[model samples]
Target: MPIDHLNPPTGAMADNVIGFARALRKAGLPIGPGAAIDALAALQLIEIGKRADVYATLEAIFVKRHEHALIFHQAFDLFFRAEEDWKQMLDSVPLPDDARRKPPPASRRVQEAMAQPLKGEEREAPQEQEIKLSVSDREVLQKKDFAQMSAAEIAEVTRAIATMRLPQAELRTRRTRPDRQGVRLDLRRTLRASLRTGGDIVDIRRLGLIDKPAPIVALLDISGSMSEYTRLFLHFLHAITDARKRVSVFLFGTRLTNVTRALRARDPDEALASCTASVEDWAGGTRISASLHNFNKLWGRRVLGQGAIVLLISDGLEREADSQLAFEMDRLHRSCRKLIWLNPLLRFDGFEPKAQGIKMMLPHVDEFRPVHNLTSIDGLIKALSAPTSGHHGPLIRPAA
Candidate 1:
């Protein structure tokens, strides 16, 4: 493709594409000035009047990831249109009852983006008004359930989550390093120091066990029951992965899928897009036993070493009562130094181990905590940071 079309005429079509690009950027696609220019050039190669050709041209130029496709489509429909079509849309025409149908409303982000003033235009400021506030907006959001949050709120939470960092909780290894005040004596190092002193004096060298941050292995459930929570948790995991190189991530629904490399991308949006593309069983039925079995047999030995911490994020609602679920859970617990079960269902005050999977797996987890809101996630961070003895002992639930 000869991109010589860059010198296209600055016609009304050019203006429309520029305005459309602005709307897309506001709606969260990474549209820059160069992208807008490229879009214009690509449009010059296609039939301007044909909507399909125009859409394809602009989409190819602007849409970098799969998740942005919906936002792009919505913005394109609302931004690009003929005056007559807009007039017809504004002034509704009467139609037979059966023929009349309501169109799906645009997403809040797209609506707000399109409502913004175009280039060289001024936006009217809101009138000042006195209002009394109790709690701040963020305070309320911290406790709000992920499933109940609005798109705008979710965006804010995602940004907040990006800033959150995991504490560098280190574990001592068998390997030792020379230390000035270490308890254990290093005879070899001490003898070497004596030789350097020509046996006149001996400088005793002490050794201490090497300490490094524990690796994190997250197995997230992407089943229908966990779709909302897992999506938000993935953003949190992305932050963890960015800060720590030893983090490994896996997504499980009907099967186990390793997404560690995909999440290693620096950009959170791009990382999530790659994850969505790699998984074919998103929002499907949960097969906890089978998924856990596969994970233990394949990835357990690889990622569970070096005193790694395992995060099991799921509702624990298995589709089938597989007898292997308990065995797999135990195997996983044994492989990892700490196994933390993060269940969104724990947000409920009356939550109990009623589900077969929950009951079977609960006993193996070192900690069972809620993962439904930001506060809960903060609690998880604290729990991981605080030092505790190995194997807190199996949990015995009250009989139903």
Candidate 2:
């Protein structure tokens, strides 16, 4: 039956629909009230052949928050798609499969060569070969470490991260309204009562907008130890930035440089190239305490005004891991919403936070996680979607 034509609908129809939309939002689609209305309107356009049609509308309306896109994508497949029992059936399909000609291997098209046969059995000319631009196989290889990677693999990982979008990096905030159950004021209603207090003279008004912005700041280390990973981290920072306007990004090693401007460049290659030129201390010694002291004192007030989540990306093998490092690390921990330290060292199968530098930094971080591979980046998305658990990592540093 058509939903609109199904008689006087149940009194709770709107409530149930709202609840389902909220679940989709929690799963990662950026659905708000307007989109919910759009979803309901879509139901009218589609035939109510089954629940799948209803679900398809909801999924179509809410699947754009890139990070949660994958989850919603998976949920739509698993939830909306009809489940089927399977029995193994084997059959060999015939030669019609070869009807699809083989793609010319690396632009070595036999047809093109035939079209321009060799002159006097000598090669006519080395024609411009087309670069087949696709990323499936290359993306698979980046799940391994760079130190263990071949040169070609390294180049491929760079290109992939330059293009990957980080989903669920958007912040969530709470808002207050008078009709909300947890609202703090009844002033308008109370003022009506206060008219009786002053001989029926209404003498009061109370209303306010309550909001909490997700305070977030990042301190990325660009030390010699972090050279490889830091370059990749910049890509993540850039993706986060294009999604949100006010994110803060800083690069540190021997000194602190606010490369927010450098990162904002539209081209990832240009952005990283500009950042490299702007930084004087690239692949230099780590002076963690000094760089952070500058951040805590100079830029903290401007960026950390809101309860910002601080992301510290580094290997934590500080050149100077002294009382000063402890002091600065402690100061930084106290000034942010959540302090997450993403150590590439954590990628090792057998790792521990046992190094003196890591031991010092670890106790202060609210969470510790790896940030080296595509799988690790995906995990970061999930962690950002909800919250992190079992946050621990090994002490292994990247092999030189």
Candidate 3:
């Protein structure tokens, strides 16, 4: 039987759908009123009491991305449960161990959204309470690890990263452009000027070497352990990519995938979505050595020219031999003007170079830094802005 025949389009059911949509929107799904209306219409075409039918109906209308399916189901399970179940849960009634069924864990954003009062609902105002923040919320967020952040906090941080501007790490190129006080004399222009003056008087035109922002090539690890930090770092890279045209981004897990073009989109969310769709090995096993070898073999000379700076963002965990990793790291370091290693593992208080991969790759990087938080990113901008002239020696600054 159709849902309309059994569960008709009641006002209560409509309200429930709208409220559920609100909860999902809060949980980071891009749900709007139109989606809720569509979901309700879809529900009318299916049997409502059958959980699978209802879920499919709503999911077809609401869930657009593969990654959001988990959030949708978690919210669905919590919102569509029996009223008695909610009462039991809210009232702190404990079920007997024999009767209890443990559900899979939900993301923090979903839990927080479910706890909040639904929009446009009238409720009594709570009693006032005093709250003090010695350090501002933004300040605290700057130092918080990306792995430890809640979904809402990640959203906030992503926005902050999108607004960040990369300092122009200028490089003096051989290519010249017209400048008033340029040192190089333009003989052709000087000759043209002499002809205009009937060969009696000559004027000299000077050209200055173009000062362009150094190209940035980022190789980010997407292994399971580095996924959280990498996802956030990609937001930062997106910001830089949009600001500058020369930035190239690559994601590596079991292999290397160039996402330079993907991140060139003006919208950060759209760019990241494109990147996620293009990458097949996200949050998969690590093969640091193989990925680096692939990068060095194919993309080394192409993107590494014009004094490019290479940012290797990884935990330096390799499942293969360290010998190959060391060779590739050396090749990459030699190709780029500056090679900075941004390791999230450096955030640990007692981090040591015990891992063979870490030890082998350490000697090749000009700078070793933490990239687990916003403050570390700020430090990176400072480091990049500093002068890079006559600096050929290996400089390894330990994490603070």
Tally clashes: model 2.
9
Badly placed stretches (over 4 Å) of model 3 are 1-135, 195-203, 387-394
- lDDT (0-100) at residue 15 of candidate 1? 64
For candidate 1, the per-residue lDDT at 244 reads 84
Tens-place lDDT per residue, model 2, 1-400, is 5544433223234444454555455433467888766666666676544454555566567765434433443443332222221001112222122222332211211222223322334332322221222344545574787556665465556656656554433343344455444435666666676767874645444444454335457788888878888887777777767766677888898899998888887645456777888899999988888999999999988997655778899988986778888888888877776787888887877787677787788777777788887666666656555432222223223321
After TM-score superposition, the amount by which residue 38's alpha carbon in candidate 3 deviates from its true location, in angstroms, is: 23
Give RMSD (Å) of candidate 1 vs. truth. Answer: 8.2
Instruction: Give one digit per residue, the lDDT tens place, for model 3 in 72-114.
Output: 7667666755334333323343333422333232345567667
Per-model lDDT: 0.76, 0.62, 0.78
lDDT agreement of model 1 with the native: 0.76
Name the lDDT value of residue 47 in candidate 1. 60
Off by over 4 Å in 2: 1-139, 150-213, 387-400
Clashes of each: 0, 9, 0
TM-score of each: 0.70, 0.55, 0.66
lDDT of 2: 0.62
Q: Which window of ten consecutive residues has the lowest lDDT sum in model 1?
A: 125-134
Q: What is the lDDT of candidate 3?
A: 0.78
